[model samples]
Target: LREERIDTVVNFAAESHNSLAVVDPTRFFRTNVLGTQTLLEASRAAGVTRFHHVSTCEVYGDLALDTDEVFTEESPYRPRTPYNASKAGADHAVRAYFETFGLPITITNCSNNYGPYQFPEKVLPLFTTNALDDEPLPMYASTQNKREWLHVLDHCSAIDLVLRKGVEGETYNVGSGIEATIEEIADLVLELTEKPQSLKTIVPDRPGHDRRYLLDATKIRDELAWEPSHGWRDGLAETVAWYTANRGWWEPLKKRAPVSEETAWR
Candidate 1:
């Protein structure tokens, strides 16, 4: 704690909920951008090298659009929400540290993260917890929001690659082979929850909701051989089973608060 025993620093901490950002843009910017800077300043003061900046694909925004291309490390940043814009700013900050100060760092922009221990705020767990509790599942916008999904374990593994084997001053995209729409995700959750028949609730949409997000992981794959072992369907099933079996973990969360109607949809 005193002399920088923390040789490697990982910066995966950020306010990442897209819908939440729409409701409170100022909070999103303050936490995601300013928080990252605060960490970087601390790491710089501590003389830490081997920093890993874990980021998301929403920085690219709207991959389902006819004009939107799959996001690479070099793609132009066109973030839709305050959440993503903040991350984009943080990404630039890391790059600056790498170039000017020569900090040993790797930036990994990854696909949608899913797996165990994920809070119910995210899409997979959110719908799962809500539907399993027999609460109506609130969907935002069109069921067509597409995202490339990666299991949390796989995502952590990819971060390890960036930490250990990834090249310094380079950015890599990490992704699973599967992609799905929001509606399809809801249907899957319903099937897993055993058709309660009354738990489906589709709302209008979130304001400025990104239509699709896709990450191209060729760099991570070709460079570090980071391939995914879980499919969207398989991972969804496994995740559903975990939440179902471990009501002890999620019940408190559902009981603690109701879903925010303000951030529910557009």
Candidate 2:
């Protein structure tokens, strides 16, 4: 930081997979928890002006699928999975630095992000890529799991807004205020790729899986004047189209981590 005269640090590093975290929580802890602390210390020592931490709404845990509930900035932390627990720990650490050492830090807990260049391991990419190749779209259990989706570009815009106009030591929830089920995403992917719905395959659910995650992003909208410009339907179609047009980008990635039944939980 000193050599480069860096004034800001944005932490986006994480081993962010639910099943992977369940298999080995230590990796998530080391990267998400301890790594965040290390960065916080370095930022404080280096006199960084702004330290922004990008987090996940999973830290607020899941809401009942039948309810109209949504997670907000004031929601209590109730992380169910190892990945989310590690993130919750990191969120606490970011706040601690601000309260204890007076570091100028702001945090944004965002919803699921989908767009071009996303690793094929994630839900949107996995389904889109699989449908493109005429491979089975693995639907975990009943495929009833729901999540709020945000475009990656919109997520970046929210983070940019938080960094520029947000108050230090404050945490914001950034989302599209739109939630969709896993099955719905699969159907959309199949439609976009012109693939048959018969390619959908049922797989066992991950242990300790949360049923739904919906974020109430009123704070960011009212405070920072931030809103997602991309509608979910159009954004998802564009994403699937991008994957279709650029097989070179995701083909090698799929080869590196070939989709399998065991690694199918998204």
TM-score to native of every candidate shown: 0.93, 0.97
- Candidate 1 lDDT by residue in tens digits, 1-266: 22748888998788887777776778878888888888877787778868889987878766765544677777889887788898999998888888888888888888888888788878889889888777777776576778778999889888887788989989998888577887788888999888664676777676677877777788889989888877778888999999989989877876766447444544
Mark the regions of model 1 whose C-alpha exceeds 4 Å error after superposition: 1-4, 65-68, 196-198, 258-266
lDDT of 2 by residue, 6-110 (tens): 899999999897878877789999999999999999898899999999999999888998999988889999999899999999999999999999999999999
Top model by lDDT, which number?
Answer: 2
Q: What residue runs in model 2 are displaced by over 4 Å at the alpha carbon?
A: 258-266
Question: To one decimal, what is the Cα RMSD in angstroms of model 2 from the true structure?
Answer: 1.7
Query: For all candidates, what are the clash counts?
Result: 2, 0
